[model samples]
Target: MDITGERASESLMEDTTTEGSTMVIKMECTDDQPQMRENQEEVEKLKALLAQKEQENDLLREKIQTCQAPYPLTPETINNSSVPNYFRYCTGFTYDEFNKLCRFLRLPDSETVTQTHIPLNCDKLDRHTRHMPLRQEFLLVLIRLRQNFDLEELAFKFQIDIQSVSTLFSLWIDFMYDRLGVSVWPHRDIITKNMPDDYKAEFPTSFAILDCTEIKIEKPSSLLVQCEIYSNYKSTNTLKSLIVCDPRGSIMFASALYTGSTSDQEIFRECKIKDLLKGLLQCGYLKRGDGLMVDKGFLIEKDAKELGLKLNIPPFAKSSLRMPVSDVEITKKIAKHRVHVGRAIAKVKQFKIVSGRIPNSMLVNINEIWFVVCMLSNFQQHIIQT
Candidate 1:
């Protein structure tokens, strides 16, 4: 104990020595090591937190930009996997038929639908966004035509405004018309090859069954417009057009929409369907004996002979006590075939856009709308089986 006390006394007495100074320095470094480690750990945690917050903020900002657009392109439900399966009920086309329509129109895939675009007629819908796919827009237009949904209904369903709907309807109709408007009259040999026995037995060399259909329209406000569009026969304002279909009820040609008061013969003259027939005959689309059928109302018998095509119109009855048996049989036969053209037109009218009273808003683009409806009718089950 005496020796230990003597050593401690000596150690204190030498506190200013170099060895004691080194010992003090080592102790101080050990004390600071823990604090430095703790600070480094805290700095790493703070960096991780800041990185996480930055990612969240970036995502939030992107979504906000989408919401702030005037005409948001994001579809509410129609363009995504959540869309319903009742597409046919809404747009008058099944998925398969819609796909076929895309292929037929040469429209782009939904992934890159903006490849070929129609110029917007107005600035309201000019801000194209990724909200709605082009395929969905096509369906919207078809649904409007098929179901006759009001603008409000379309807007709520499509998440767009009424003006957008009107503009889209107008633009898409023209786009479809531009692609599908080409005449497709089949050749004589092609017709004969597909001729059903019913037609073969009656009229072997027939080309088309021609008729005129009138679609009622809203009464115009201007007296001059009213006078031009009022149909004396239908006793209403309407639009008329010539529709030509093959024996199988496939529409071959359609004229532009004319004033409802226009005569069938006038449309036939103006539509150039007669000229087309002449060209077809000259180009061997019709053989020497090939003829087209028409209702007796068309006064083109003289023109038919000049064009080197026969007319199988029903015979007219003279002012006699009763019709002859031959004329009656002929009328019966012609009437049976004529029913197809009427059925084709009726099927087109079933679309309701052209079937119901057409509003004046559609008057300017009525011709293209009419053609689109008529063309879509070909997608249905064939009206005449054979």
Candidate 2:
């Protein structure tokens, strides 16, 4: 121990004799070593922190993509993974029928078929966001009677712009109506081909059951337009349509749409549903006592008699000298049997597509839409019965 102490004292003494001091050298070495180690450790920690933040940011971005707009999640629920499934896809109609109808209408298809430089703007959205073809989930909801939804619920379901839903509906109404309307009306050839065998035995002259229903319309901007559409029954602005149903309440014919201001008789005259009936009669496609049962509003006794078509009208008070009591009683029975028409109308409006006040943009398409709904009702009822 004594020798070691003597050596350390000599070494200290020798270093002290040099130009620079040993204590100064020792202090500089100690300061630089700790600082360099701390800086390296800090840089590694900063890189880890930056990587963690980057990962968190990527996670946040994905959540934002699926988040509901204008219905921000609370802080507690932001990271929760148990969101409800709401958005529905279109799969109601049979694939065969849907594709056939699309082809029939000449609508463009995104599947397996490409056209070069087609000059049409039929696609509702552009390619960047067009992961799926234009889908009407709202209409499918109605057609399928999906119970878990309402208009507001669907606004979040599809991640679609709300106003865009309304626009899409109007456009679809036009497309469907135009396609099905013509088919519903009985062509002379079709009427001959599908005539009931028993019609010749009982009522050989019966063509179709005619009735009217008022669909509510949004109040017009002008008072004149308001007065024109206002119906006395509902005491609201409504558009009236004439539906001519077959015996089972399937609408076989529909009048062209007219302003609510037009009287039922006037609409008949102007739009030529009556003229078409007369033409059918002239061609022997329709015969008289071919029982024409109409509501009291259309009390055209002479025309019915001249057309060789038997008119069944309800009993009016003695003061109104239009038709005999016998005719009224016969009409009453026909009306009773025809109440199914009202029931058919009720079934049709149950579809929310037609239940609401239709958009003004779709007014032109209403007639065709009416026919399509009727056909669907008939098709559904047939399916149910069979």
Candidate 3:
């Protein structure tokens, strides 16, 4: 009996020891699994953070490239090159027109706060010195008209600071874009008078012509913006502006500011040009059979069809080299009629503000300048017609 009892006790002790060992193993295994899961989660989080940083870095790199790129016309290059004279002729500004503009702008002999204690009606805004030499001010104005001046050359030729030239430019451009921007389409009464007699008698269905022009800008620091602003034609950084012209070729409409990167199709949508066109239509001015001529880039065929309006485009020539006889004939006739819009575009570009490459500035006030120029163009055209 004693021997049997001892054997059973020893078996019971062994079973307890086995249970203890199993509990320790299970606890260790559970703890290890949680640690492994935690490590994996940490690794995933680090990867996400890394990707985010890379994206930010890419954006920053693009920004840097846009800002640091060199402008085409340095002061030295402009003084030496024939480009300035070419610009003057293309822009249609004679010495007389230049002087007249100076007088109109109140540029020459406008009392500067620094020159005298004379407080004119004008108050200073940024506390930046508005006291520039009259020549410098004139040069700056000319820049707005001729946009191709060598800032460095102007500084050297006129003996003024380049920064002053740049500051005046930025300020004036802002003024032009914001304050002087004209409507995309004039009121019905205004356009009705100018409609061609034949068209008024017959179809009475003509409205406006639309086109886009590229303006160069200084390189941006951002690579993305740089890539965006770089146009194939200019082979430089540029912004695209959309202009709408009346039958007389006077700009009835101009768009708000857009980056150089914007495409014509995107700009049309972004600027809501359709809204302006609709306004003219709703006013009962533009009829179903009315027509507009546009370059291929406008991509407005669908809209024209829906509106029951005719669009005149020179048919794409079969051979890239020679235009079809029908296409040539139509193009020549259209060009003659569309001369007013061309002239208007030419006048707007005359304001040095629209002439050359502009800097990638966030605060360009182009709308006001656009309006003022339109008003001027209207005034000038009437004078010429008379």
In candidate 2, how many Å is residue 322 off?
16
Candidate 2 lDDT trough over 10 residues, lowest sum: 70-79
> Which lDDT tens digits does candidate 2 get at residues 202-298?
4445556667777877787898888878788778778777777765566776666566666766665566666767887787667655666577786
Q: Tell me the tens digit of each residue's lDDT in model 1 across 1-386.
A: 69999999888778757677888899999999999999999999999999999999988865654444343333233334355656666767667777788778766665344424544344546444333456667777888998999989988776777777877777788878877778778887787777778888999988789999999999988999999999998999988999999987889898998997788888888888877887887888886667778987898887778787788998888886588999999899989988989999998888988888998877788888888889988876787665
lDDT of each: 0.79, 0.57, 0.60
lDDT of 3 by residue, 1-386 (tens): 69999999999999999999999999899889989999999999999999999999988765553333223332233345666554244334444454465465444443231312222212432223344333334444445454455668655544446776555555555544443454445655566677766434532445777777776678889888778777776787876777777766667677765666677778877787777667767777565666877775667777777667788755666665888787787776666555656667787766665566565453355555544555455434331131
**Top-scoring candidate (lDDT):** 1
Stretches of candidate 2 exceeding 4 Å from the true structure: 1-124, 128-155, 162-167, 187-204, 282-284, 303-308, 315-332, 358-368, 382-386
lDDT measured at residue 145 in model 1 versus the true structure, 0 to 100: 93
> What TM-score do all the candidates reach, one by one?
0.76, 0.58, 0.53
In TM-score terms, which candidate is top? 1
Worst 10 residues of 3 by lDDT: 113-122
lDDT of 3: 0.60
